[model samples]
Target: MDTTMSADTVVLLTGGTSGIGRVAAERLAATGATVVAVGRDRERGRAVAEEATAESAGTVAFRRVDLADRSAVRDLAAAVDDEYGRLDALVHNAGLASATRRETADGVESTFAVNHLAPYLLTHDLIGALADTPGARVVVTASSVHRRGSLDFDDLGFSSGYDALDAYARSKLANVAFTLELAERLRASDRADGVVANCVHPGFVPSTGLYRDVSRRAKLLTRLAGLVPGVGTSAAKAARRLVEVTAAPEYGERTGLYVGGDGPEEPSEAARDPETRDRLWRVSADLVGVDPDWP
Candidate 1:
């Protein structure tokens, strides 16, 4: 870990209203980093940021954003650029676990839109600002459940059929693919030297609102899983791994890396598949109207 605090470094975190993002925002803010938290609920988002800033004795602020809207994400990026002049880190932590299939106003599936496309679009729009700062980091929160997800590009929007679990898993898988591919693309470009990208699985953190959409019985089962000696852990514990990944000195040279619970474990077979990663990058760029030139 760097163990060095710098107030000048700014971290923009999504889904800062609750759960892991909430804890992370506070911790980063406390470390003298300026934290700009993004969430849909204005009250909750502001409260979280305020609490974080209060606890850290550092700078923390909130911005209301429904990431599912592409234009909103663009505006948010513009606002960040204007306010901060540079974005040092971006944590794509916002996510949703919907019980039923729903579509956003943009005609994209809600799960895919919120979980994958929003972050993809946001990161792309802010890449210039991040590259402007040397030694900047991009940390994406992924999930171990990505192992179960097989990308079906033709039905990416869950158009033909949709299962909540499958859709969620696919979105998480997209996160991994996006992170890895982004790392590859950025590493080869002028941005490679300073702006590094990485992704992580925070482990099966229980009571993280990740199971809020599941049935009561399912929630009970998840609670039970965490209780099983060494199972689903606390969000605080999970956040440590994520925080360390972003701030650690050891990772300074390793970009496009997929990290697991115990340091840098190997990602799933699917996550490491170069072909799948490339294809997902193309499809995601097509969906978001960004150039697939990075591929």
Candidate 2:
């Protein structure tokens, strides 16, 4: 942990109350940073903050939020900036999987709304704060399953057919594409030297609550998979991977990288395609009603 960096830094981490995110919160705070942890569960969020305060050189603060709501997302961004003024890292660790298709309060698909659109809009609203902080980063918790995803803009909501795993994979693909595009934009902008964006694949972590909304059979199968030898990722290990990307020096300069346990590597063909990345960024901005061009 970079105690000096952590002591001077401010990190906004969503889904900080659970799974790898929960562990990462404590770890990040231990590095001596003021970590603002966001999640819907007030108790868990507070508990994380309390634990981090007790165990680490740094500290954590909890905020309750429903990322599915656009207004709430905007308000959260506003509050973060109003309080912190500058942001060292914006970590999108929050995500979900749904067995059946549903729409958010904003009428966007629930899975896409929470996993992709929420972060997209939040980033747009916070890029200025990030640019003000030297060596700031945007760390997205993408997944390796993105290779199996199809980003069909016409069917983004999966109205034609919906599968929990497929929807989750697609959302992660969007995360990767968004990171790639955002990195390019940040690099070309006046704030290019300060802000960097990257995504990480934490591997198959069936131990997390991410699959809580999946079908019963899927849940049972996930549990069974967890019992298998070396099949499931431990929350502790995954959180370390997240911590590495969030605070490690190597990532401070690198942008558009998809980091995994092995380190930075190329992502799926679809994710690497400039056409797909640009289209996703533009479409995401339209869905969130933000300007396509940004830092």
For candidate 1, give the lDDT: 0.83
Q: What TM-score against the true fold does each predicted structure earn? A: 0.95, 0.97
For model 1, which pairs clash? none
Supply candidate 1's per-residue lDDT for 119: 86
Model 2: worst 10 consecutive residues (lDDT sum): 1-10
Q: Could you tell me the TM-score of candidate 1?
A: 0.95
Model 1 scores worst on lDDT over the 10 consecutive residues at 1-10
Query: Candidate 1's residue-wise lDDT over 134-249, tens digit each?
Result: 77788899998888887887888888987888998999988888888888888788654477889889988887887899767767888889899878778898888777777777
How far is each candidate from the true structure, as Cα RMSD in Å? 1.6, 1.3
Q: Candidate 2's residue-wise lDDT over 1-295, tens digit each? A: 4432558889999999999999999888888889999999988987998988899998899999999999999999999999989899999999998999999988888989999999999999998899888888899999998889989999899988888888888999999998998888887898555788999998788888887889999999989999998778899999988888899987787888999889998899999999998999889989999888776
Q: How far off is residue 131 in model 2, in Å?
A: 0.4
Output candidate 1 Cα RMSD: 1.6
Off by over 4 Å in 2: 1-4
